[model samples]
Target: MDRFESLAERRIREAMERGDFDDLPLAGQPLDFSDVDDPQWWIKRWMEREQIDTAALAPMVIQLRREADGFPDALRRFDREDDVRAYLEDYNHRVKQDRVESRFSRESRIIAPVVDVEVTVVRWRELG
Candidate 1:
């Protein structure tokens, strides 16, 4: 797992151990990301709702965004179309597999908290 995934997993384990979402006021509330698709969007919402220091999570958010955008650039750098297609296909397959595992893994429990913190930190880092 990458940094974001590792961090997310850790946060989820911590939350489950505590039985409450740490540092997030909405821990007990139902979460719906249907309208909020972007990591940054969720960060802002969580910050506003939780009234916490958003700066702390800025680096993680930027890192996650960077990773999210990485595959396309990686594929584009390939010299051959076939190579690019192969890379993309492999990437997609890996992503799908990870998604499936994440859905069933305990680490997924922390996805929301990790995302929330990441966005807040990103905003905070930008301001600083």
Candidate 2:
């Protein structure tokens, strides 16, 4: 095993000296990933490339959290304060319902927190 390992290392060193790896793609560039936190990053990249709706595969709590994260941007579609309030109220209602169901279900352990409608309303007005 040691003999084979040394032979492989010597061949790699000889190749490097011969500039055999100089023209390889992204030879001097940094990798796209800056961290190793997400293990499913390759799957995500493939999904994006295929134009798949990756969100559909996520849990409901994750979906709600994603929606809540983009709530400010989604508010741009609403032209009226009443519409914003109603939308937020509906979202909060779903959060509450999911929280109750999650507690009773064995599969789901994470329950998304309800959005604060009045605070979100103020944010919506600010976005206008």
Candidate whose TM-score is highest: 2
| lDDT tens digits, residue span 1-128, model 2 | 35556877988988999999988987898788743578988887888879999678888889998899897789999999999999998899988888887887788487676888888888888888
Query: lDDT score of model 2?
Result: 0.85
For model 1, what is the C-alpha lDDT against the true structure? 0.53
Off by over 4 Å in 1: 1-67, 109-128
TM-score of each: 0.31, 0.57
**lDDT values of the candidates?**
0.53, 0.85
In candidate 2, position 6 carries an lDDT of 84
Off by over 4 Å in 2: 1-51
> Alpha-carbon error at 49 in model 2, in Å?
9.2
Per-residue lDDT for 104 in model 2? 78
Model 2 TM-score relative to the real fold: 0.57
Q: Candidate 2: give the clashing pairs.
A: none
What is candidate 1's CA lDDT for residue 36? Answer: 73
* Model 1 agreement with the true structure over 9-83: per-residue lDDT tens digits: 888887779877566776688878675767588767877888987555554334344444554443444555556
lDDT of candidate 2 at residue 31, scale 0 to 100: 81
